[model samples]
Target: MSYGWLDDDTTISTDLKTTKETPFYEPIVNNFETGGYNPSVSYHYNPDVTQYHYGVRHPMKPFRLMLTDHLVIAYKLYEQMDIYKPRRATKEELLEFHSDDYVKFLETVTPENATKLAQTLKKFNIGDDCPVFDGMYDYCQIYAGASLDASRKLISGMSDIAINWSGGLHHAKKHEPSGFCYVNDIVLSILDLLRVHPRVLYIDIDLHHGDGVQEAFYLTDRVMTVSFHKYNGEFFPGTGNHDETGLSKGKHFTLNVPLQDGIDDESYTRLFKSIMEPVIANFKPTAIVQQCGADSLGCDRLGCFNLNIKAHGECVKFIKSFGIPMLVVGGGGYTPRNVSRLWCYETGIMTNMKLNHKLPDELPFRNFFQPDYSLHPNLGDRLDNKNTKKYLENLKNQLLENLRYMKGAPSVAMQEIPPDLQNLTTDEEQAIIDKLNSESSYDEYLENERYWINEKDQARKHELVE
Candidate 1:
C-alpha cells in the first residue's frame, strides 16, 4: 500500500516554473554561532522512568528506555557523557506548559482509582491511547523532569548538549493526553529554553506529526516548530500538511516536511538538509530541541517508512554539525529492541563516540537483538518509496517559498525572566563552571549573555572592569 500523489510530472513542472518565476529573497546569513565545539554532554536518566507499563496490548512501552540505557552502558558510551538521575518534575514545572487541571488529573488519577475517575479520564482523553497505568503520574513526572533538568543544564552554560531518552512526548496537549503521550515534555523543555534563548527551533522526526508541541507554540514567533513525518490518508494525528503554515505573528515559522511511506535514507536526508539549511539560515535559532522518534525506522511495528537505523541517526548527526546548544529526546518507537539500537546509536553520535557494529556481549537484553546480534542489522525494505524525486523537489520548493517571507531572524528584546524559572546552580557545580571558564579562552562569561544567566550583573561586572 502506497501513499502520496501518483506521478504528476506536469504538475511538478508547473510548480517548478511558478517557483522559479517568483522572486526569491537573498539567503539570510545565520549569526548565532557557537563559540566552538564543546562536547560537554549531559545524559539524564532514572530507572523508574522505564518501569511503568502502558498496557499489555498497547504498542507504547516504557521499558525501551531501560534497553537504551543498558546498551549505552554496555558500549561504555555512558562514560563519555555526564550522567544524572533526574529529579521528578514538580507540579510547578508541569504547570509551565500543561494546564493546572491536566496536571492535577495526572497527579491524582491512577490505575487503582481510574474506575472512579472515568468521567475525568474521558474529559482528558486518557483511555486506550493514553491508559491510566500503575504509577502513571509518577512516570510522567520522571520523564518530564529529565527534560526540564536537561534544559536547565543548557541554560546554565553547563553543557553543550543534553540527552533524555525518556522525554519527547510530543503529542501531549495543554489540557489532555493524545497518541500515548501524557505530558508535553518537549514543549515544557522548549519553554525553559525560551526563558533565555532569543529564538528556539523545534525539529521532530517522528513517524506521526508533532501536533501537541506545534499547537503549544503555534501563535508565537519566538519558537519555530518544524516537523517531518508521514502525513497521508488519515494518519495518526492527521496534521502537518503542505499548506499548514503558521498564523499571524508566527507566519512561515511553522515548517512541515510531510513525507510518504517508504522513504529511503538518501532521499530523507537530502530533503531534510535542503529544507533545514534554509530554515536555519533564516530563523537563526539560538537553541534547538530535536525529537528523535525511533518509530520512523524500518521494521518499526507501527511505522511505514523503510528508513534504517543509520538513516534515522543521520538526522541527529546533521543537526549536531550546527554546533548549537541542543537537547535531544526520544519519542515514539514501538519495537523495543530496535528502539534501543537506534537511540543507543544516536547517543554515541551526540557524544562523538563511534560504536561498533556488534552488540555488546555483556548487554543485559542480549536476546532482544537475536540471530545476527548486530547493532546495525539489515532492516530490509518492507514498502516501496512513494516519495519520488519530483514530489520531493516540489516539497522543497514550497517550503523554500515559505521561508522567503522571513526578511531575517526576528529580533527578540531581552525580557525579565521569572526568578523561579531561572537556572540555579549549586556551589559545587559553580566551581566546575568557574574552573572551565578560567582554563578555556572561550569567554564563558560572554557566552552567558546569550543564555541571559545573571545578565544584568555580568554586564555591570564587565563595565566596571573596562
Candidate 2:
C-alpha cells in the first residue's frame, strides 16, 4: 500500500512493545452474567455503508462510519452492547414522510440518468450537494433502516439507549434533499417514537442547522426540536434562528440555540445544560433523538467551532445522563478521521464503559492520527470565540421566557394496557368490518391453504379443483 499523507501523520512508536489490547472497558452484564444485571442497549450497524461514496472531495464520507466501527471494535465497545444488523427500510416506511413522487424519483434516479433528468435534479436539488451515485437509494435505506431499528428498540422498551451512527441525515425535507442528506432518517425515527412516546425531544449539535427535522414536526406539540448550530453569515441551509419557535399548537415547542464561531467546551457545555435542564423539566419527554455531528470539532475542515473531541462528547454524555430512551446518530462530520474518533468515543460513552485513553495497538486507523498519538488531540482555540457569554445568557433567557407558552408536559392520549380491538362488538361495527373483509376478499385470496389462490378467479378455482 502506498504511504499517503495519512501515513505521514502517524508518529512511529520506537518501542514496538504493545500495551493491553482491550482498554478498561466494562463489559455489559448479559443473561449469563453472575447477577444478571444487564444494561439495556441495542446497537444498529450495516457494513454495506462503506461500499458507497459521495463524489470526490464532497466532504461527506461513508468510510468514516466503517472506520468508526473499526475503532469501536478495537476498543471492545461491542461487547458491552447488543449488536444487530439493521433491516432494510421498506418503501412504505420511506413513504411515511416523503412524497410519492419524491420517493419515485429517488428510487429510480441513477448516476447515468442524473444529467438526463435535469428537471428532476433541480426539483429535488440533487446535483453536486445531493448527487446521484451508485447505491444512493440503498445507502439511504440502510441508514434509515438503522435509525428506524433504533427507534423500534426505544419504542418496544427493548433498549434504553440505541445507537445508529450511519443515521442523522437531518437536511432532507419531505419532498426535497439538501446538504448531502438524501433522506431524513431522523424524522422517520421520530415519527416511530411518537407512536409510543407522548413527548419526544430532538437535540441536534451539528455545525449546520437541522432545518429538515425542525420543519417536519414544526406544528406538532408532541415532539420538540432543539438545534445548536453556527448561525452566522454564509452558512448553508441557514434557518435555525432563535425566534423560529413552533407555530399554532406547537408554539414554543421548537428551540434553536444559534451560536457564532469558536464555541468551546466550557461555553458550549454551560449553554447546553442551561437550555436542556429546563427543556427536560418542562417538556418531560419520554424519549430523545440526539444528532451528534462531529463536524463542530475544532479541527474539522468545514466547521468553525473550536470544540475538541471531549467537548463534543460532553453533549452526548449529558443527553445520556437523562436515562431516557434515546436514538443517537451521526450527522455532518467533514473530517472523516476526526468524525470516526468522535463517534467511536461517544459509542464507548453510551455503553457506560470507562475506556482507557490509550489507542489500541491494532487500530485500523492508527496511521490517521497526527504527530500526537493520543486519543485526546490538541485542537485548542484554533479560532476566536464569537459567542460571548452575555449574548449566550440572553439567548437562554429568551428561551426560558418563550417557554411560558407551554404550561406543562406535552400531551398524547394514553394507550390502553391491552388495546380494545374487540370494542367494536356492536352489530353495525361487525357488519362494516365483515363487509369490508368480504369486499377485500375480491382483491385477496381467502383460505387456510399452503399458498394463497385467487378466490375470485373462477377459471383458476376450476383448475385448482383436481
Highest-scoring model, lDDT: 1
Summing lDDT over every window of 10 consecutive residues in candidate 2, give the lowest-scoring window.
416-425
Question: How do the residues 337-384 of candidate 1 rate in per-residue lDDT, one tens digit apiece?
Answer: 999999999887887666667775668979989998878887747899
lDDT of each candidate versus the true structure: 0.86, 0.83
Q: How accurate is candidate 1 locally (lDDT)?
A: 0.86
**Minimal lDDT window, size 10, model 1:** 22-31
Task: Go through the candidates in order and give the C-alpha RMSD of each one to the true structure.
Answer: 14.5, 11.5
Q: Write the per-residue lDDT of candidate 2 for residues 1-466, one digit (tens) a residue.
A: 3422213245654333333432445543334433343348888999998899988868888999988998889878887789999788878889989999999998999988777898878888877788789889999889999999888877777898999999999999999899999889999988877766788999999999999999999998999999999886568787888899999888889998889988888999888988898889999999999999888898798889999888888888877777778899999898877888889888877876655555666787688865665566766599999888899989999988887778888668967452222234568687998999898886555343423333334445346542
lDDT of 1 at 45: 96
